[model samples]
Target chain A: MSQLANVLNITKAPQPSCQAQRLTASKSLSARQQQELRAILEQGLPQVAQPYLAIAEQINASPDQVLAQIALWQEQGLIKRFGLVVKHRQLGFKANAMVVWDIADEQVDAVAKLLSSCPEVSLCYRRPRRLPDWRYNLFCMIHGTDRAIVEAQIAAIVDKFALQAVNKDILFSVKAYKQQGARYTKKGNCHG
Target chain B: MDKQSRQATTPVAELTALDKRIINLLQRGLPVVERPFLEIAQQLGCHEDEVLERLNHLMTNKVLTRFGPMFDAVCLGGAFTLAALAVPEPEFERVTEQVNSFDEVAHNYRRSHDFNMWFVVGAESAEQVNNVINDIESKTGLPVLNTPKLEEFYVQLYLPA
Candidate 1:
């Protein structure tokens, strides 16, 4: 398959059944409720015995309502995952690298799947190349507590995938200016 | 003390096995129920209060940067693209400040590469995404190579604590 066609095949989101559910959910919640929920969630879930009840009290909604809304949102895919967002740095994962590869068009998908299954490989995706300036098409992220370990993992990944001849680059992050959850709804307003 | 000295003196908080377990469980996802903590505690064979306490401690210690619902900006009618700029070594800091000045630029990272500065720009529309890239180029006077995901093969991270 062509590179574009290969990408298109995997880029497809969930089927229509899930999409229809998300659409129904998009209109089910009142704008005011969504705004209030978004505001509370943006602050992060409060750690308490009854967290939902706490949210309910703050939003002036019932506990059941808050729980139901969150459940619905998760089902709709509005909320990708609702849980603890660990600071990798704090978890001793100080060394992280974004490895980009110019895999052959036909083998990109198979290579991506193999790379994604690697224990050290955290994130893998296919991005378009910028031609003369940028040539790598496949990207994967590896995180380790030390720089050397991360580099070793990358070397192993290349060998395992038989990408010896492929052009690749490993970009280790030197600084992080900003990293936070995507804010879809404004703090006070539901609409962005 | 100066900023550099203060950072050097601060001790890194250690993670216990229980803390690791908590992180592992939470990463999978918090149960969608009225008393999710209770369920977690039950599974871990601990009390609900203990689970709550550890979570509170983790948040306080900054082990977990956030703990809540993660929204997909694209699904919510927003556009997001990953772009990078090959900034000159001397002007890197100034370019970083200029690029980060825009509200649309969500995550910016200084990576080791010719195209060194990488960031994600999220906006309400495709037009805004393009505009942000243009604005960054104008401000930094560097060519911005936009490499938005043509396709996402698999996007997930499961870091075992």
Candidate 2:
């Protein structure tokens, strides 16, 4: 294995969260199934062909059943999206920023609709405002190679959109304490 | 996206308490393994098949947007950043549509502000990240302020509540 891979393998997984206490699901699950689910969530999804089948074997279920159930949940929209986690910065794109805009409340939806469509914008959300201290409501992220290019995009938005009447702020990320999506399984399984 | 768009999917009030509990549990994320759902079932003291059934039900209903691993882009040898633009009231939709089309952009949402369009961009390289920003500038005619993370204190949006 490459030196880095070897290092990664040996490094004791950052300690398991003291929060690893078993959390109860809504309806009680069978003892075997509960153990399987908890282990999966706490560790990670299996990485292999027919991963679902592998899971079934662990829990003593047929592969078809596992596949069917997963499909069902996905169709229901309980499962949002499933994609790979690309560790940013490790790839050398270190610069990161958070840009906020003050879109008129009346036009906010229309404006948000526009932003959400952009693939460059990864995460977008609306948070409660703190008045003059923070007026810009629409938020998005634009990652790039340098600050100048990033700035140019913002300037273009102002000019093209004629957003002179609103306020703006760019909050850049410095040190990422933790960056992971919600587990959607249980609590006390990891540090919050 | 904002809460409004979410409302169209399904009213949270309609979900059963058991559904809510399952949702709450999975929101944090399932185990990272070959058979995470099975593992979760075991821990929850239920049949693995049942756990999968519930998850499927929730996903199809649109109660959960996704269920998967969220990697730290920074750790993966890539560049990512967050930025927002103040879109004009009239041209908001057009500009947002344009921004959302970029392959590098993962997701974007609307906030209440003059510069109200917020989104995130991920790229295989730093240069690509910048290129995406520049592309947005020309495409949407908006100044893309690249807000590189200066100090990430803490960011965990998932709440079991």
Candidate 3:
């Protein structure tokens, strides 16, 4: 591991909201089976004693086969996360802010590493800076139960990172018009 | 602004202690097993039927927008991009409806900025994604600033609700 990775690995927040995680990107899909698996997985497992068997029956696969495929897809990074996707605001995390930062090219990577390590940051990604109109490239999402908690968290990150001079914008999500998992090839999962 | 959009300011009312516990545990993930809910119930020291019933209720009531596998669209041979539009105040509602009419739009959020309406477009391929963008621009008569992820450092979302 590089020095930075080593440093980030050991840096643990006392009150961790999310584990210090890394996301590996995938550019292409491999098989049709995976696609079908994804669509079925999106609807999620049925609430039953033999959920895997139920899923298997849909695609003409066995229970063990379904389980193995899920494990394989996760390891291969096709499925980012297989769990409950809650409406966060419904869960008392009403204050959600997407903080975008304009960082110097050379420092962006190092800064991103540090920002990702913070407990408050649920998501940290380096996106392209659209010149003139949109200059902020670094995006991080912070969620709190209320506005005061969110503001305090942001202030602390700024102070800790010496980011007083950085140009950034905090865009709190005003409303969610539409939110759902990607329906990639919806043909695979629909039984009706 | 509209009936479809939920206000992000207020918490959903009438959540029991068990509901909170279920939300917190389910976020981690349910194992791939013969009886997954039973395992979760065992872990939480609750009845399996209660877990199943509460989960079904949560989804039915939109407390849980989605449950199950979260796929990286890009990984599944799909194109994904974040696009935004600065709609005129007078036509905000109309424009929102116009932009959201497309099935490819997976997520849309009204944010506090001039480019106020931000949404994510997911399609089977890059060409399709662009087609959706073009359709949105022409339909709404507003330029869509499409920004895709250049690099992802970290993305894991788990909240204790």
- Per-residue lDDT, model 3, residue B67, is 72
**What value does the lDDT take at residue A175 in candidate 3?**
80
Tens-place lDDT digits, model 3, residues A8-126 = 65332222112112332232322554456557777766766677888777777677777777766667656656566566666667888889999999988878888887767877777
Root-mean-square deviation per candidate: 5.0, 17.9, 7.0
TM-score (second chain) of model 1: 0.83
Q: Where does model 2 exceed 4 Å of error?
A: A1-35, A38-42, A159-164, A176-192, B1-161
Per-residue CA lDDT of candidate 3, range B7-108, in tens? 744556567788878877876667767788899899999999999899888888778866777655555566677788988889999998898788888668
Model 1 clash pairs are: none
Lowest lDDT sum, 10 consecutive residues, model 2 chain B, at B151-160
Residue-level lDDT tens digits of model 2 in B1-161: 55434322323334555555565466445643456666767767777777777766655554444455432333324566665677898997798679877766644655544656766676666687788899999999888756654322112122223
Question: How far out, in Å, is residue A165 in model 2?
Answer: 3.7
List of clashing residue pairs for candidate 3 = none
**Ranking of all candidate structures by their lDDT, best first:** 1, 3, 2
Native contact fraction per model: 0.60, 0.05, 0.60
Worst 10 residues of 3 chain A by lDDT: A12-21
User: Taking the tens digit of each residue's C-alpha lDDT, what string does model 1 give over B1-161?
Assistant: 75323322444569877787877787667887888899998989998998889888988898887887766555656777788999889998899889888887766788999989888877777798899899988888888899886655444456455
RMSD of 1: 5.0
TM-scores of the candidates are: 0.83, 0.43, 0.76
lDDT of 1: 0.74
Error of 2 at A17 (Å): 28
lDDT of 2 by residue, A68-100 (tens): 544433343332224422223322234455677
